[model samples]
Target: MVAIWLDGRMRPSTAASVLVISARQVQRLLRRYRESGAGAIRHGLRGRPSNNRIDCGVRDYALAIVRETYADFGPTLAAEKLAERHGLTVSSETLRKWMIDDGLWKNRAQRRNFHPPRLRREHCGELVQIDGSDHRWFEDRSPACTLLVFIDDATGQLMQMRFVPSESTFSYFEALEGYLKDHGRPAAFYSDKHSIFRVSKTEARTGHGMTQFGRALAELNIEILCANSSQAKGRVERANRTLQDRLVKELRLAGISDRAEANAWLPTFIEQHNAHFARVPARPKNLHRPVNEPASRLRDILCWRDERYVGNNLTVSYERKRLILEDSDLARSAVGHYVETYAFADGRVDLRWKGVSLPYRMFDKDQQRVTHAAIADNKRLSEVLAYAMEMQKAAPPKMPRTGKQRTRYEPTGLRSPGPKSLLAKRAERRVAEAAAQAVE
Candidate 1:
C-alpha cells in the first residue's frame, strides 16, 4: 500500500481503506516514506522492551521462588500459589514461557503425542465402532459401572448403548445382542484390542483361535476388527468422552442411578442425541444387513459356546459342576468325543452333540471356592472380589476344607448374570407392536 501511494496511483483515503488505518496516518506514512524510504514503515518502538514488563528483580525473585519451592507445580497452580503466599501475581501463560525457557516445563507441542486423523466410512452401517467406558456415571448416587457404546462411524449415530457392572464377555454379549436386534448386523465392528474383542494372549490354549464374541460374529457373517491403538478407534473413544459429560448430566437430571432404569430410558436419550449430533453419510446408503436367523439361534451364537471332552461315564465337568448326561445313545456317542456347551446369560448351560441338545442331570453342582493361589486376571478381579464377598456373607463358620474343596464359589458362576437377555424382551416388544398394529 505504501508503494502504491508513493507511485501516485492511490489517494490517501484509498490507502487508509486498504490499510485499515486513518487517512491522517496514511498521509504521515507518505511523508515518512519520502523522507526516510522503506525504514520509515517500521514502528518507532520496534526493538524496545514493553513498558508493561516486570522489573528484573521481581522476575528474578519469581523464578527463584518457582525453582526453589514449586518446581513440579503446574503454571496455573504456581501462579495461584505465588499470588496467595508471596504477593506476586504473574499470568499463567507468562510464567509458562519462563518455565519453558528455564527447562522446568515442556511446551504443549513437546508434551502431546500426535495422531493423524482418518476419514469416516462412506455408509452409516459400513463400520460401527464399539467401546466400553468404565466411569462413575451416577456421581455418588450409585457405584461406578461400565457403559458399552456402539456408534456408527459414518453418521456418528449412537446405534446402541447399555450399562453393565463391568466390561466382561457377557456384558458385551448383552450389548451386542441389543445392537443386532435394533440395527441388524453391521458390515464390521471396529473396536480396541480388548480381550473381549480379541485374544490378547497369543499363546493361550483356550477358545481355539478366536474369542467367543469373534466366533459369534463369524456365525452372523459380520466382521470383527481390532484397532491396534486407542486412537485407531477414535470414533467410539470420542463418543465415550462425550457421553461421560452429557449422559452423566442427563442421568442426574432424571434422578436415575440404577443401571436398569437408565437402560429403560436410554432410547429417548439416544433419539435426542442422534437428532443433535448425528450427521448425513457421505454415501446415502445403509450397509447393515437384516438378521435372517431366529432369536433362538442368535441366543445360542451370542452366549459362551465352548467344547468340553465327554468322560467315560457320560459325565461332563463344567465350572466344577458334574453334568451327567442321561443314559442314551447320543450321550454314549459323545462319551469319547468333544461336546459343545452353550452357557446362557441366564445361568443355563446346554450340552449339545453336533447341534442336538442332550438332556443332562447336575450332580455335585456346588460352587468351587476361590483359593488364595487362584490367579484372578485383572479384567475380572472386581467380579471375583464381589463373588468372594457374597460367598463370605452366606458361608457358615468352619475350618478351611481340605483337598479340592478349599475354594468354594457362590452358586452364581464367576461371571454372574448381568441384566436378563434383551433377546426375550425385544421379542416380546415386537409381538406387542404387531398386536397393536393388527388391532389398529
Candidate 2:
C-alpha cells in the first residue's frame, strides 16, 4: 500500500503517516523498491545453498569411512571419528541424517524416561563417585575387562580411570593411588555396595567391621560412603554408560585391544572429555586435602592386610600358603604371636611384627589351579575358563597299571606292614576253619 501511494507521487511524510512509520523508513522502502523491484524485499540468500554446507566430496569421503570403519558406531561418535581421523568435519546432526538416510543407523521410537536431577556438590573433590564398568571395551580383539572410573560429584570431571582384569580390592587400591597422586585425598568417596568398599555380610569377620578398601581409606583419613541404591550414585553410574559407549569406540578406533594400551590412552581421553564436559563448581575451592602421610605409609595403607598367628615352629599360613620365619631370637619370640601380613597388588608380600620387617621363606602348600573360578570376576570369567581348558589339554595323561593298582583301603608307605600283616592272616585262617567246621 505504501509503495502504491509513493508511486502515485504521495509525499514521504504522508506515506510515513499512513504506514505509521518514519519518513526515513518510507524513503528507504522507496529506494529498495526502485533498485530491485518488489521481490528483492525477501531474503537475498533464501534459494541459495548454505555457505557452511559440507561439500559433496567431503561428505562422500566421510560416509565411505563411516561405512568401512565405524559401521556400528552411533552418529555422534561416527561424526567425531570422521573429524578426528579422516579430517572430514561435519555436524553431528548432519551426520545423523546422513546415517539415517544411508541405512547405517537407526532412530529408536522409544522415549527415555526422565530421572529426577540431584544437586551437585558445592566444591570439587567433595565427593568422588567411583565405580567399575565391565564391558567388551576392545570388542573381540581381546578379552573383556573392567574400567574403574572416579568422577567428581561437583564438576563431573573424571578424576581417574584404570583398566583392570576385575573389580577387586587391589584394583581399586591401584586406582585410588593414582587419584590421590593426581588430586589429593578427597573428603569422601561415594560408591556402590561392592564388597570392595562395603562388607556384604553382617556377621563377617572383619575385626574393624570394614573391608580392606574401607580400612585403607580410613587410614588415609578419607571417608567412604556406600550408596544404598544405584540412583544414589547416579553420577558415576551415568558416566559408566557414557564411557561404555564412547570409550569402547575410542579403543576400537585406536586399536587398543589390551588393558595396558587402554590405560596408556586413558589420561589423554580424560583431559579431552573433562575439557568438553566438566562443569564449574558452585564453589571454587578444592575440597581435596593434601595427604600428610609419606609415600611408604600410603603404600602400606593401600595394600591388602591381614593378621595371622605364628605357630610353635614360627610358621604362618596365608591363602593356603605356609611361610617359615627365619630362626632368630626375635623370630623365635614371635612364635605364638600375631603378625601382620601386607599383600600388595604387584604380588609383593611383607610380614611385619610391631612395624618391623620379618624375614620369611614361602612354601606353597596348596597347588594353584589354572582356573580361579571362585575369585574371577565377570570380566575375566570366560578367559579364566578358556585358560583352564587349555591347561587341561596340555597336561600329560596318567599311565595305566597292569596289576599293582592299590585298593581304597590299602596303604602305600616306604616301610612294609610285616607283623601286622602276619597277625591279620592268622586271624583270617582261624575264622575260615571255624566256618568250615560249622558247615560240616
| Maximum-TM-score candidate | 1
Compared with the true structure, what per-residue lDDT tens digits does model 2 show for residues 169-250?
8889999999989889999999988778887787976577899999999888999999988988999999999999999898
Error of 2 at 296 (Å): 1.3
So what's the TM-score on candidate 1?
0.66
Measured by lDDT, the strongest candidate is: 1
Taking all chains together, each candidate's TM-score versus the true structure is: 0.66, 0.62
Model 1 global lDDT (CA atoms, 0 to 1): 0.89
Clashing pairs in 1: 368-408, 368-409, 369-407, 369-408, 369-409
Per-model tally of clashing residue pairs = 5, 0
Query: lDDT of model 1 at residue 161?
Result: 94
Writing each residue's lDDT as its tens digit, candidate 1 over 112-146 gives 98889999999989999998888899989998888
Whole-structure CA lDDT of model 2: 0.86
Candidate 2 deviant stretches above 4 angstroms: 1-116, 365-367, 370-440
